[model samples]
Target chain A: MSTDSNPITTEAEEKKEEVYEAEHVHKVYDIIAPHFSATRYKPWPIVERFLREMPAGSVGLDVGCGNGKYLGVNPSLFMIGTDRSRGLASIANHEFKHEAHVADALDLPHPPGRFDFAISIAVIHHFSSPERRVQAVRSILATLRTDKENPGRALIYVWALEQKNSRRGWDENSPQDVFVPWVLQKGNKSKQPKEKSQKQAKNLVETEVKATASPSGDSAQTRAACEPEEEKKEAEPNPVYNRYYHLYKQGELGADAVEAGGKVIEAGYEKDNHWAIIIPA
Target chain B: MKLLTANFITCSVKSCQSVTPALSFRDAELAREEIDFSPLFLRNILPRIDWPLLQRTAKELGFPALPETKPELSPIAEGDEEGVGSEEEQKLLKELHSLLLETSVQSGKLVCANCGHEYPISQGIANFLLPNHLV
Candidate 1:
C-alpha cells in the first residue's frame, strides 16, 4: 500500500520493512525465491487442503513465508506472511503486506499468545538441530499466546521430515535442509497410504473436516511431505503435460517436534485425500 | 477501532517488521470497508507489490484472477483478454480496491519493516509510527 513505483525496487518496500530484521530470515528462503512458484514449486493439493482448513480473518503467521507464496488460501483470511528473508520483506510489501516483514522463526520477537495460529511450512529442517526446530514452533505459539484475548491451544503443522529425491529440487548440496510434513486427521482408522505410489483408481474423493483452533484440543499434525523424486524417476523422461508433485513419506518430523515447541494440538490426515485443519484466529 | 490504529505506533523499534503489526484474519475482511483504493490506484500499485505474493493474497482476499504480470499503466491497451481501452477493465479494476486494498483488519498486529517491530492494532488502525530510541 506504500507508494511503491518500482516493480523491482526494494527501496520503497524497504522503507516499510525496517522492523524485525534478524538472522536466518533470508537463509531459509534464499534459494526458494527465484525457483519458487505457487503453481510450479509445491503441489496444488496441499494448498487446496490449507485453504479448506485455516480459518479466515484470524491472526496467523506463515513461519517459512518464503517469497510469500501461499499455495491456495481462502479469500477471507487476514494474512501477514513472514520469513527470515529480509530481502523478501519488500516483496511481501509490494504484494500488499499490510505488515509483512523479515523476522526469525527460530527466535521470534513476539509476545506470548499474540497470534491466533502459527504456521511453518517446509522450514523446520533449516535449523541445525531438531531441538531448535521445536523451539521455534514454541516461540511462534508464545507470540500467539501473548495476546490477552488468545483463546488457548495453538494449531501447528510441522512438515514431518520426509525427504525424497524429487522434492529435493534437484539440488543435492544438503539433503537435510528441507523437510516436508503431511499426515491424516487424529484417531482416524484409515490405513496409512503405502510408501509406493499407487495408481489404483478410486472414486473421486474429497472430504472436509471443520474443527475450531483454540488454546485447547487437537493441535499438531505431523506427516512427512510427499517427495516428488520417486514419482518423477518412475515417469518416462521428458514427459510433459502431467503435474509433478512431492508426496512425503516418514521421518520428516514427530511427536517430539511438537513437545519441543510446547503444548499443541496435533493434526494429521485421516482419510485418503481428505485431510483438513482449521486454525482459529 | 480507529482506521489508523495499525499504522500509528508508539514503539522504538526502527525496523519495518517491528513497527508494523500482524494482520489478523479479521483485518482482511474488515479492511474491505475502511480501504477504498481504486483500480487506477492498484494499477499503480500492482507493479510495486510482489506479484506472486499479491496474487495469492488478492485471491485470498476475494480479488478475482489477476494477470501474471503487474498491470500495465495501459493495462487495457496491453490487449488483455478484457481488451485494450476496454471500459470493462477499468470498471473491474475499480472494484479490485474494495476487494484487496480496501479491507482493513483492525485489532491485530503488523510486522514492522523498519526495525522488525510488532505494532499492535487495538482498534481498526495499524499503528506503524515509531518511537525515538529504536528509531
Candidate 2:
C-alpha cells in the first residue's frame, strides 16, 4: 500500500470532529426525541398557539429543537431540529426526528430568507458572553427576511426561557439573559435604508433597555440615565436588553419555541405568564 | 422586497443595517467556497461553516446534508496522483454554499422534498405552511 493511495480519504476525515468532549450537552435530550409526544409531556397547550398562528406548513428552524418535542406535539409542522451533537441528532432520528439535522444554531446554513419563523429554547444562556447571546439571537432572526409580495412579511422570534443567573454570564446578576421576541415585517419598506440613522437605532436600543429597567415605564434612575443635557454618554450603557420579559432561573423552559412563535400571531400570551414585547413584524 | 445581493441586511432588536463585504470573488481572492476549483478551499472553508447548521441547512435548502462529525481537513484530490490538480471532488464545496448560501429562492410553495409538506415561500419568505384542516 503506497502513501498516495489513501491520501484523499485520510484528508476528508479531518473536516468533522467530535465536540463537547464530555457529551454533557448531548446527554440532556438524547432520549427526549422518542418519548417527547405531547401525549406525554402535556405541554402542548403552550406550544399549540404557535402551531395555530403560524401559516400552516411553514418551515420551522428549531434551534436546539431537542428531540422534536414540538414536532411530537405537532408533527405536521415541517421541523428541522438542529443540534451540535451527533448523538442527540441520531436519537432524534430514531424517535421524534421529523427531519433531524446535526448543526450549530449560531451558524445556520439555509439561504438568507429561509424560514417563516424561528424558535430557540433554553440554549442561548450556554454561551459565555452577552455578545454571544446577542449574536445568537441576531443570527436566528437572520432567517426572517422581508417578503416581496406581502410587502410586510412578518418574522416571529420567541426567545423565551432565559436563564436568570446563567452560568454563561460574567456575573451572577448580569442582565444579559432576557426574553426579547423580535418580529420583522414589511410595510416599513418605503423608508430608505439611510432614513433611520444609526443614532435612532442606538436610541431605540437605549429606550428598550430603560423600559425594561423601569417597571413603571419611567423611573428616576432611568430619567438620570435618559437625560443627555449634562450627562456624558456611557459608551456601553445597558447595550444588552435588561428589561421586558421575565428571566427564568436556570431551567424553567416549559414552552416550545416553535409554538411560541406561533403564539405571537394568535393568542398573544393569553395563557402563559409570558407576554411578548411585539417588535415591528 | 429589497434586492440585497452580496450585500447583507443585518438587524438588531432596535435597527436593521445593510452591509456589503469588500471581498470580491476574483482570482486574487479565491473564496473558501471555491473548493471545486481547488481542494484547499474546501479544507479551509469546512472549518468556518457552522457544520451542524450547514447540515441542517443542506436539508433545509433542498439537500439532505449532514454536519461534519469533527473538524477534519484533508485533500480532495492529489495533484501528484492525477498528475494534475483535479477540481472535480471539491465541486460539492463550491456548489454547496452556492446551493445553500448565495441563492435566496424567495416566494414559492416550498414543499419539503422529504416529508411532503407544502411550505409556502410567500413575500420572499419560506415558512412551512400547514393548513387548519391538518391542525
Candidate 3:
C-alpha cells in the first residue's frame, strides 16, 4: 500500500525492505504459483528469440524462472532456472526435467562469470526498494561470462508503468509502486484462503475491492466485465492475493542495468513490459 | 538437478566465492532419465564442461571414470551438419549425453567447500535459499 521513493540508507532499512518483499511478493507467489504458472505458459517473443539464437551447448541462467516455462525452449542450450518461491520452483521442475532451484535473485547460486547468458522475466520488479532491484540485476549480470571476445548477455523484463494502451491503463502519471490483485477462483486446487475464518476472508476481499475501486477503478470493473457470468454468481468470494510491483518507466530498466555494471545493448517496450538486453561492461 | 547443472553452480553465500572445488555432493541419490541425444549439442557444449569437475562428480556418483583429458571433437563438415559423425565420435557423444544430460541428482545435498553450507536437493530440485545470517 505504501510507496518507497527515498534511497535505502542502512542495512537495517535494506533488511526491512526484504521482509516487506517477503510478505508482499514472495509469499504471494508461493500461494498463487500454480495459478500463476497456468496463466504463464506462453513465452514472450523476444525472450524466445533470445534463447533460440543462443549457440547450441551454451549454458545460461533463468534467474527468476517461474514455472520453468522457458527452460525447455531451445533444448540445445543448457539452462538452469532459479526461483525464490519453492512452490513455483517445484512446479517448474515437476512439469519438466529442466533444472530449477529455490534461490533469491539477490543471492543466486550460480558461479560468477560462468553462464553464457541469463534471463529474468517479470521478476526484479518484485523488489520493494530501488537498491534491491539494482542489486538483483547485478547478481544476475555477475553470473554471465565476461570474456572480451564472447561477452555474456542477459535479457531482463519488468512490468512497465507506461501501459496506457493496455486494459489496466496505467500511464506516466500512475504510481510506480502498487499492489496488483490476483483473483484465484475457489475451485482451483491451489486455492486456499490466507485467513482461516470465512468472515475474515470476506473482509479481506471487501477491502481489496474497495482499494481497487478507489482511484484507478477501471481495472476492477474491467476484470468483472471479462469474467464469465457464472464466476460472478458464485456464493463464496474468491480469495484475492495482492502482489506488490514496482512498474518500470521508460529507460529505467536500461539505466538500472548500466548502474549494475552492464552496458544495455537493446531496450524497448514489448507487450506492456519493459525489456532490455545487457552485457557486462 | 542434472549432473551437468552442478558444474555451473556453487555456494550462494557471497563470502564463499573463492571456495575451491566449488560444491561437493553428499548423500546423493541419482536417477537416469532418457533424453534425446544430439551429437552437435554435445560437441558444442564440450568446451564449457569443466572436465576435472565433471570427472570428480561422476566418480562420486559411482559412474565409470572419465578419460583424464577432455574429449575434443572436430567440427562437423558443411555437407554433414546433420550427420552423427564417425562411429567413434558418435559413441563418445552418446556417452557424454547419457552422463551429462540424462544422469540427474534426484535427492541429496550440495555442500560448499568453503562455507560448508548445505543446499538440499529433493525430487531433482535444489534449494539454495540460505538462512538470513548467511545472507
Each candidate structure's count of clashing pairs: 133, 37, 1
Q: Write the per-residue lDDT of candidate 1 for residues A206-256, one digit (tens) a residue.
A: 011112211111224212233323245443332111111122224234344
Candidate 1 chain A lowest-lDDT run of ten: A200-209
> Per-residue CA lDDT of candidate 2, range A181-221, in tens?
11111122212234344334323332322222222233443
Query: Please, what are the lDDT tens digits per residue for candidate 3 over residues A102-169?
Result: 99999898778889999999999988777888999999999989998989999999999898876577
Candidate that scores best on DockQ: 3
Sequence-dependent TM-score of model 3: 0.87
Estimate the lDDT of model 3: 0.82
C-alpha lDDT score of every prediction, in listed order: 0.40, 0.37, 0.82
Candidate 2 CAPRI classification by DockQ: incorrect
Model 2 segments beyond 4 Å from truth?
Answer: A1-40, A148-281, B1-135
